[model samples]
Target: MAKLYSKKKLAEAPKMLPKQETIDFILNYSKALKVVKTSNGTYENIAN
Candidate 1:
């Protein structure tokens, strides 16, 4: 969910990284865009 990645008011949020398995889950389960992390720490959306 987008809420999972949203910033909280009081505490610092934990950093999230997307792996291949996670991308697969997103593709299967949700309507969210699939994204992969690059070596330089940027995200690239996976094409459907």
Candidate 2:
């Protein structure tokens, strides 16, 4: 599936569309991605 979140699109989007679920999903996905990166050691979790 095409991503519901896109960095480029988000950068240009107006600041209104993110309802609670969208925000929650982004937060959860980011956390999970960080854990995956840490476990694989292929990418650094620079946000920390």
Candidate 3:
């Protein structure tokens, strides 16, 4: 019989949040973008 799982300890990872500038930039830029999916398997940008 073989071992089912590893007995090694996992390391602790730190979580970081996005900067204020990055969040604001994305919010502004994303507002002008529009995406639409057609009958085919391709994505189309319908923003005008």
Cα-based RMSD of the predictions, in order?
14.9, 13.2, 4.2
TM-score of 3: 0.47
Give the clashing residue pairs of candidate 2, or none.
none
C-alpha lDDT of residue 43 in model 2: 62
The Cα local distance difference test for each model comes to 0.73, 0.64, 0.72
Q: Is candidate 2 or candidate 3 better by lDDT?
A: 3
Clashes of each: 0, 0, 0
What lDDT does candidate 2 reach at residue 23?
A: 95
| Superposed model 1: Cα runs more than 4 Å off | 1-17, 31-48
Ranking by TM-score: 3, 2, 1
lDDT of 3: 0.72
Query: In candidate 3, what are the lDDT values of residues 1-48, reduced to their tens digit?
Result: 255465555776788899999999888777867777678766646343
Per-residue alpha-carbon lDDT of candidate 2 for residues 1-48, written as tens digits (9 for 90 to 100): 356555355356567777899999888877766433455576645354
**By lDDT, highest first, what's the ranking?**
1, 3, 2
**Any runs in candidate 2 off by more than 4 Å, and if so which?**
1-15, 35-48
